[model samples]
Target chain A: MYPKKFENLIECLRKLPGVGLKSAERYAFDMLEYSEEDINDFIQSLEDLKTSIHHCERCGNLSEDNLCEICKDNRRNKNIICVVQHPKDVIAMEKTNEYHGVYHVLNGVISTSKGIMPDDINLMTLLDRINDETQEIIIATNPTVEGETTALYISKLLENREVAVTRLAHGLPMGGHLDYADELTIIKAMEGRIKIK
Target chain B: MYPKKFENLIECLRKLPGVGLKSAERYAFDMLEYSEEDINDFIQSLEDLKTSIHHCERCGNLSEDNLCEICKDNRRNKNIICVVQHPKDVIAMEKTNEYHGVYHVLNGVISTSKGIMPDDINLMTLLDRINDETQEIIIATNPTVEGETTALYISKLLENREVAVTRLAHGLPMGGHLDYADELTIIKAMEGRIKIK
Candidate 1:
């Protein structure tokens, strides 16, 4: 409905994840409200993101260099790795501040419905890392059926290997209200309950 | 936290309307997934939005040139002008394709809480245009207290003018369920109901 330049921008923005036509236009038009200096800075930020970043060669996580900050850090638990489905999960886990271990991003879970296979993910590096002998491998994929299937597959592959395999404990989240928890969640919480010594 | 470049991009994205830290990170990471050429093209789109567009001299609508497309197009009804709060509203009205008239963007509504006054809006050129003798002025501000206040203020200002002052008729929106319509909206609908001859 707008000019070619404006419409082209909307189309380009729609290419971004989760952004629909209305949202793309909103983003474009909202950016127009920003000052020239701010807009230039934003453009510079985008350029930097594009030019200076890549997947970490070691862990399949995002990085500016060959190794991500977590993999490069000597202080972090180098022997322990938490396997997640995406980089966003890495960010989410990092926010907890409870886990100081490194991460291995599988990129995506095995989903036949989505046409995603084991080969399509960053599983090769994970298998190679496991063969090299890690202290522990924590599977922290989402609690979905696909996540469970992927976790089970990876655990089975690492069964013969000399590595401790663990899954994120299935329970109600720490801050979650008990009253709001569904029957399945309640059951999982009850089944996963641990004795405090 | 991620690399400096990635974090910077997320921060910049967070400046957009309705985008939170999580969504901003998602946008940055998704953009990272795009090829270099595609990312560069997106950067160009943003640059075009920033550099090429400005308010129309005549109606305060968005334009690459001095006058917006609507103002430049002589085929549009110059005699009837619809007053709106922003360029977004202009697009919304345009989508309906019901109004052949031009528009005058207030740029902002008068909000005491936000410290926005009538002086802050694009009123000077509106007065100049009105003095040039438009046949009608349609106030299409959002149906809020601020909108009604602005509409009434503008109507009072144009009391002595020859132009017919009109407000967008307030009523239950077309296809709206009566069960969901608020009491105020129902009252407005009743008050504004037309006799079916």
Candidate 2:
């Protein structure tokens, strides 16, 4: 066994995602060797994370203020909204540099097995944000069952509304080998095939 | 592309061993979900690690007090000392429930490639601790080139002394299959093999 404080630090480190007992112990040992300034900076950062960051009131993305960077950008298309499962998906979408639309983060998808319902996530706020000027509503949730369920539920809610609702294309990704493509993806790709000629 | 404070927290988490950018981001996100109490507790643990823990004055093992638990214990053999490369090795040696002697942590091994020399570690302090009451000095460093070099160097220094110097035996570990054993390990096992009656 290690000293009391050493063990306590290990326990704290172990609470992080994917860190095991060995890794926690190793991190604790490594952190002990860090300079006082580095330790203080780390502590300050953690403290700031708790005190400063909050979800964007408009789009549900992480933000230091009420609105996120994307939501505040005037050039981004407010009429076209891309609905995603989490704030991280907003980052992924931003990396593409193609879509100029703002994002609506659901924070979670509907999972019946996990007992999460339609009312559990940021779904209704999305509907509230849609105005007469809103042109397209893109359902960009992951292709998983829960993501599909949430997407379908959102589309059903917008059925009476005039806004165009579309799901992201499901197919074998670019640069991916055909042999590695799964049956479901191949089927979806075939169903959504376009006539190039 | 996260918030400033979120990015700062990720950078801090990335400094930990085996944590990459993605993992650090995930840890930051997960930590953001932690209760204020939990975050404060983690911060307190890190602070305690810096303030409370110190090297044992006698054996160089990690301790809250001036002397380590083993050094202060009356039941342990004061006549024998196990010289290890790091404090972690003391924990490993203690787990065996054998070796009732106190430990001397070298903090590091002599490695020419890494530019570590004899004077860089706790080598001289070990010499000071070797009094007339000391009987055996067990070299429990790892069986690497640097470990072997340090062990040989220590033994040579104690050649004229009354204390008995010994190296830990190298062989196929217990529960190891011979078919899976490496050639060097097999050779060591053969050399150290005991004759059956």
Instruction: Note the Cα lDDT for every prediction shown.
Output: 0.76, 0.80
lDDT of 2 by residue, A72-138 (tens): 9999999999888887777766665667889899888899999999899988999899999998888
lDDT of 1 at B4: 81
RMSD of each: 6.2, 6.2
The docking category that best describes candidate 2 is: medium
Error of 1 at A141 (Å): 2.3
Candidate with best TM-score: 2
Fnat of all models, as shown? 0.76, 0.81
Runs with alpha carbons beyond 4 Å of true place in candidate 1:
A95-100, A131-133, A172-197, B95-98, B170-197
lDDT by residue (A97-125, candidate 1, tens digit) is 56788889987789989999889999878
Worst 10 residues of 2 chain B by lDDT: B188-197
Itemize residue pairs with steric clashes in candidate 1. Answer: none
lDDT of 2 by residue, B1-197 (tens): 68988889889989987888878878988897899988998889878877888889888888899998899999999888888888887776676565688889988889999999999998889998999999888876666788878988998888888888777665746543323445565446434533111
